[model samples]
Target: MDLELYQVDAFADTVFSGNPAAVIPLYEWLSDDLMQNIAMENNLSETAFFVRKGEYFELRWFTPESEVDLCGHATLASAHVLYEHLDYDDPVVVFETKSGRLFVDRENGFYSMDFPAWPFHEIQVTERVAAALGARPDKLYMGHRDMMAVFENEAQVRELKPDFRLVAKVDGLCIICTAPGLDYDFVSRFFTPDVSIPEDPVTGSAHCMLVPYWAKRLGKSQLTAFQASARGGVLKCEDLGDRVKLSGQAVTYMKGMIVL
Candidate 1:
């Protein structure tokens, strides 16, 4: 069997500056085990597989260890592939995903995605959480998808040196450390030790909760976010009550054929 693979750097203008995701467009559904193995082989943060279903596309995201409910960068990379390489000509691209129906619209060079705004509530900060992140958080929120640790400044968020082993003991899919940004509205870093992603370069899905939180706190609906990783990323965000809009640019870094 043969498969086409494209690696795209999401939320970056040039190559090697953002989160790179492997995208594979398929004609039919491949076995879940095969897809998981492919994701592991690629060793990226997330691998996306999509099949055209009538007028829409069916999308799935997998990490090295397991499949996830939702992923933002991979979804953007898939849309970039369809529009640039696959000759997908449509004003709006719709995808049926594990989370729900997602809509992507292209304008200028940015691809804007509409995603659900996950709800989060305040949670007591425990000693284990403080030990994992190497600092005690000012506040902690238990989000539907992850746990958020709020700090005083962007420097505090950036200076974190998390112990992944200890992070696994904390409850949440991932630990999101965020604070008020120096330039942008907010800054964040994502860590998911259980899924084999120790520190995600630029996590779009984490902004689902961050946007809403910052929007309400800043007293504005439109906001900007910066993911303070080694590669880094910038995102234009908008809070739409129950939904959030994330927009960024993606560039194709490499393309090849995978033989099995």
Candidate 2:
């Protein structure tokens, strides 16, 4: 069998600048193992698979190792594929995901994604955490899906070189290190030892936690963010109480067929 695959660089104006995701448009649900294997073969940070489900589509995200509850960049890439490749005429597309309902709308040149805001609480920084990050953060917090380390400035977040082996020992599926940006409102880098992604170039989901924290501290609802990865990403962010809006652009990188 042959499957159509589209690789998209999300949160980027051009190709090779942001997080790249593989999108497979399916007509029906494939077996869990098959999807996971497909994601592993693709070997990207995340691979998105979607099928038409009633009025909206059902979406799932997989890393090389496991399926995640939610993913931001892949969702944006999926929406981009629909609007640009699948000839979707609607301005808005809704998806049913494990994380619940997700909506993406085309506005200007950016794809605006509505995602649930994650809540994290301040935690005492541990020696293990310090060792993993190579530097101690000004503040540390714990959340359901990730642990956040807040630094004093953007340089601290950008200069990090975490030990992925030690990172695996850290609590939570991933670690988010952030600080006030020099050019933008905030800057962040995501490291995941639990998944196949050692460092995500541009993680849109991390902004769900970053936006809320910065909004309360900055005393505003609207913000901008820069992910401090090698392939950096810029995002327009907004905090809306229980939800957050993240807007960015995507570029199609490769279109091909996957033979199974």
- For residues 1-260, could you state the per-residue lDDT of candidate 1 as single tens digits? 99999999999999989899999999999999999999999999999999999999999999999999999999999999999999998988999999999999899999999999999999999999999999999999998779999999999999999999999888988999999999999999999988999999999899989999999999999999999999999999999999999999999999999999
Model 2 per-residue lDDT tens digits across residues 134-184: 999999999889999999998888889899999988889999999998899
Show pairs that collide, candidate 2: none
lDDT, model 2, position 136: 95
Question: Native-vs-model 2 lDDT?
Answer: 0.95
Candidate 1 accuracy as lDDT: 0.96
Q: Which stretches of candidate 1 lie over 4 Å from their true place?
A: none
Candidate 2 global TM-score: 0.99
Best by lDDT: 1
Residue 180, candidate 1: Cα error in Å is 0.3
Task: Determine which window of 10 residues in candidate 1 has minimal summed lDDT.
Answer: 189-198
Which ranges of candidate 2 are over 4 A from the true structure? Answer: none
Instruction: Go through the candidates in order and give the C-alpha RMSD of each one to the true structure.
Output: 0.6, 0.7
